[model samples]
Target: MDEFEKSSIEGRVIELADSSRREVEQEANEAKAEQQRYIAELLKNSSKTPIVVSAVLTSDHQSIRPDVLQKYLDATILQASSFSQLCEQADLLNVKLIQHGMAENVSQSLDSRGILRLPVIKRHYPSLVYESQAISGELAVIDVISRLNILPIKRFTAKTGTNIGNGEGDGYLQFQLRNMFGGGEQLKLDITKGTKTHSSYLLDYGQPVTPWWMLNSMLFKNSRQFGNNNSIDMLIRGFRTSLRSGFQEAGAINHELFYEAEWRTSKLLSLHASDTLLFQAGDDIKSSLGHTLAVDRRNNPIAPTSGSFLKITNELALGKYWKSQVEFSQNNSWLKDDFIGSCCTFRSGYIANLNSSKKTVNTYDKFHNGGANDIRSFQIMGLGPKDLYDSIGGDAFISYGVSLFSRLPIKKWSHSNFRLHWFFNGGKLINHNNAPLKSVVTQLANQHSTSVGFGILLRHQVARFELNFTLPLTVHSGDAMRKGFQYGIGVSFL
Candidate 1:
């Protein structure tokens, strides 16, 4: 009786185990089939048709990254179910992206025949890092494409000249050129020239601001003109005029020929170098052709010259936020006849969000009396005349500083924003020789000066203009000995 019961129990247990295994296998098979069907549906509907995306960026008086908004558009287009769905998807994405008073303007423009014109995407965003990077990347891409097509832009320059001492008033000219590829390469050129003159007096005391005033202006003589791309830039200038009594006698003939070429390894970095040779012969050639060497801290020539200069410049950006540059020159009049004066500058800045910013700066000191052409400004200006042998003192200097800049818009003028910046700059001018005892005492007691200043920057974007005035709050005791109020209209670059 016991053997028979045990066998029955074992058979029942085996039956239950087999049934459980079968149920699990069936469920796994069903799940696999469902996944296969879903993937098949995605593949069957996939088409080779190109996807077009449009985006509009707007901020309610706030700045955002346009590239980030553009990325949202790209993601929607890539995952869209259909062309119409893609457009609708873009519209929906815009609504989800508004932040901090920003807005987007998106719409479709259509033609009379119902054909799509261009989709318009406008956004109001203050300049942001990502947007800047995106734009820089896009520009790099365009430059690459242009190079591949042999239509790379070669050079851009704007220059103005005036006859200061005695001449036909003031003459001005502006020119620009862009190179593109056609059957052969083509160059687009714009040239302008003009002249004018005016005079005024201060009303307070009826004092004359100037004994006489005159201006000659030059407007673009021609627009939309094209020339051979490979042709060298040729410029010819000549003027003849007489000076009245009380004015210095001046007459001049001058000409210049310049050539430039550019090469780019990537978007973030580029190299541009140009060579310009000029020649002039006249009674008062000071205004036409002359050279001077830069003086070192000790008033020695780093770059001495009076006639011609040969310059080479290299610009490199290590990444999106860092950049450096090196410049070399020869035969510059500012260089001392025996010394070569060269300079190097490195600058970098990064955005730590839309609000915070950081920057680094370093500049090499100038080597005085170190070039082939050694001419001194003090002598030229009639302050002192010393030969190179007698005026042989100079040394280089180094400056390192950091700055933090932030955007804070004014409520009254929302469109014209402002930036608040605080910077600490310190550097030294290395003298060729140690200071004399008296000079050292003078410097320690307030004979030499180091300056520190801080001020606000009023920036108007529409006009691309900036007005900055810094007040030196901290100055060495020596600085006060020679210091007067220092004021300027723009940044040092201008």
Candidate 2:
């Protein structure tokens, strides 16, 4: 406790205190190092590259094999840029598979007491515009799984707005099963049920004339090609329609069955064949309406409604220069009805690609109903005389025509096309007695006319929709046959 003793004690105490502080600092440093190591390990594990997997489950939900999942992961890696990308892509593929009816989860049984879960991962990238604007660089990654509940099967019936006054309704029921097969072509089936009614009245004197009930069946399949260019297609259809009139002795029924098959080769040549059979049964109009009404003179009285048709078309590409198509169609309706009608058409066209312009020329030869149904060029009017020639006993004859078209691009999304067409179309109508050539010529002079004209087309196809305007340069009699200028809307698939 003396002065010397007090200094010695203070020195000893200071040394002790410094030594304790050093020890504590060393321990703190060691602890900090250990904490850093732990954090480094955690980061390493998180960055160890995620193991991705994908599976296409069967209808009877079963877990996919590990090897199958690995294969899918490998395939995905080949297309992905990073681990995060791979996870996101897997989720997207799974969603797509489910949407396409390719997979299902069966964690929940049909008892409706359990929940089924599916995993989904989402990633965000810097938006292009935002990045260019130097905005916040923050990005996000979200991972979650959704649970879907299973419910019992139930049936329901409902009436649609399209249902006429008939109180008819539609019913539907669906159920799911597991253990279905995978890894095959996608299948799609469509079933439609509906009814159509057609009624017509005379324009001159409005009156309820005929009410028809039609039962139509239409089936379509997704277009599939075997090779890069070859394709095979098939279709089957049927229709039954009935015409009823209270004043008539009895109603009439018409039935139609059609089948079509097409085979296209790799060389871009397509061959199509179709067969159609029609059957009709009804009261003879001649005895019912023709004798009673003077306005029914142009109507078919006691006409045969049953008929058949066979059509074949061969489309061939003429090298890089042109394309040629030929079609032959025969109708047995006239034969069954004691009249004869048939048609043969030959179409040839050439496409010219110039430095600043393109050109096309098409020619056709048609027999039957003049060039009405066979012509590919624009038609000035839908109205045509019933007869123009006496060569054939019925209203049928042969005609040929040609059309030339050229296009030039005036600006982006805008183009101008010009078409020049000439047609020689004429046909004949049959009467009770054979008509002489002179008389037929006189009738044709009064009822028929022919001409050639040119048309200009303007079109643009830049936006989601396409617009076009067609104007005739030389307005011939047939071109102006209708009263108003022709203006149309909507895009053309052609």
Best candidate according to TM-score? 1
Give the per-residue lDDT digits (tens) of candidate 2, residues 1-494. Answer: 59999999999999999999999999999999999999778646544232222222223323333443334335443244334444455554454334323345212111122332222223223222443665543332222222222121111222323322112222222222221233211222233332211111111101111111112222232222211112222121222122222221122222222222222111112332111100111111110111001111112222211222222222222321222222222222243222222222232221221211331111111122211222222232222322121111122222233323333224432232221122222222222122454554454444333323333333233211212222322222322222212222222111
Tell me model 2's lDDT, rounded to 2 decimals.
Answer: 0.28
Model 1 lDDT tens row, 1-494: 79999999999999999999999999999999999998767645633222333223232312223443345445443345334444455455443332111233333321112222222232211222454433431111000000000112233445656433111144444343221211111122223332212211111101111111111112111111101111122222222121111111122122222121111111111122111101111111111111112212212112122222222222222221121212222222122231222222222111111111331111111122211011111110111111221221122232333333344445554333444434333322223233354553343333221233334444332222222233333333112111222222221211
Q: Estimate each model's TM-score.
A: 0.25, 0.22
Clashes of 2: 8
Task: Write down the worst ten-residue block by lDDT for model 2.
Answer: 284-293
Give the C-alpha miss distance for residue 395 in model 2, angstroms. 25
